[model samples]
Target: MPNLNNVSSPSLWQRIWQGFLTTVGTKQFFRIFAPWVKWLAILASIFLVIGSVWGLAFAPPDYLQGNSYRIIFIHVPAASLAISIYFALAVLGVIFLVWKIKTASLVAQALAPLGFLLCVISLITGSIWAKPTWGTYWVWDARLTSMLILAFLYAGVMALFAAFEHTANRGKAAAILSIVGAVNLPIIKYSVQWWNTLHQGSTFTLTAAPKMSADMWMPLLLMVVGSYLLVATLAIYRTNTLILYRDQGKAWVKEYIRGQNK
Candidate 1:
């Protein structure tokens, strides 16, 4: 007879942990999400096109900055996405370190290049906007300086991952660097408020309405949402490719590849 009295069931937390691992750690997870990538790209294209056309051509120009302000459609979205992607990297670092989720690490690594590109876009567009608005192409403003540091952090994380030969070690090193670099996020967010800088405060915030009129902000909003979707599509597509490459030798990967080739 079994000693039923001594039997213990898994705790709720344990069940949830296992569920998360199964859902995210499996290659099938990517397959389930694969269809969304195309839809996301389509939606992103629609929003960006509408937003860009409205912003660049139809929307009323700023009273002071005029058409130069239209660049915000690109600059704001890129900057926002750069910051958001770093925040995601930080979250992925935590997941990888705490749960040892390989998917989280892979996704984090996949996002680094995109994050770096977005950061560069933000900086370049900002400088272009600055030359007309601030009378200089470069400044040592806190916002700009902190954003530059973010770009370096992204580069460093990518380099750290590549520096290691062992997969586990590479993930660990990159995760740790990402976690450490997350401290810079707050500094970047509050830099304008914390110091008297040449840069202005955030254009959008949850607690307050936008300072700009609807025609100006509406298209900007569309661009922001489109940019987010575009980034998400790229991230998922890249992560899926990474997963397939990493599991190239596995039976499931081989089967998937064979099917795709057909």
Candidate 2:
């Protein structure tokens, strides 16, 4: 008879190790992220091609801003993803902190740089948009101010992680910061409502129906989804790479890499 608790078989950690070994042998990291990444890439390409052709060649120019308003396709999606991806990172950060799962922590770290990049793009594009629409290059109103704060939060998290010497400690500290910042995200989202501001309310914001037509909005949606997939793929692949590097010299990890090579 099998002993109940006295003599157990392979533990959960052992199972995880074995799975890692098997997956590496098959080059499963790319295999796992590939399909989704490919889809995102394809959709993004299609959207850019179609949106550019339509916006440039077919669709009517903006009634208010005329040709300049065409920037919305790229600018809107970038701003949306900037906020969305950081929130997702914070969720993953929470999982990492609570479970002490190395993979989860690695993902949070890898994605931070990408999120920062998005935040930068959003701010730049928003500035360009604001120049014609708001008659200025920048504003200090609620939405704009809050988004600036969000970008700084991303920088702070990256700085915090880098400031630490030990990898494990860095992960824990970053996770804590992410969780705290995540709580502030909602406040940022609602700041326009909370206070009167110069920045125009969100065009694609969740609170109201989209003001643009299908022709204008469809490509924006495509870009948003495509950007999300691209980020997720980058995060997973980078995290896996980090795991392999960190695990180097360990017996199981060596075996896992060897299997991947084969």
CA lDDT of each prediction against the hidden true structure: 0.91, 0.73
TM value for model 2: 0.79
Model 1's alpha-carbon lDDT is: 0.91
How many residue pairs clash in model 2?
Answer: 3
Model 1 per-residue lDDT tens digits across residues 1-262: 9999899999999999887767796586687778899999999999999999999999998999988998899999999999999999999999999988888988998899999999999999999999999999999999999999999999999998788736548688889999999999999999988999999998877799999999999999999999999999999899999888888899999998899899
How would you encode candidate 2's per-residue C-alpha lDDT over 1-109 as one tens digit per residue? 8778897699899999888655543235435653565566666567667665675566667778897877777777777777887887788787777755556666777
What is the clash count for each candidate, in the order shown?
A: 0, 3
Best by TM-score: 1
Off by over 4 Å in 2: 1-40, 51-57, 165-167, 205-208, 250-262
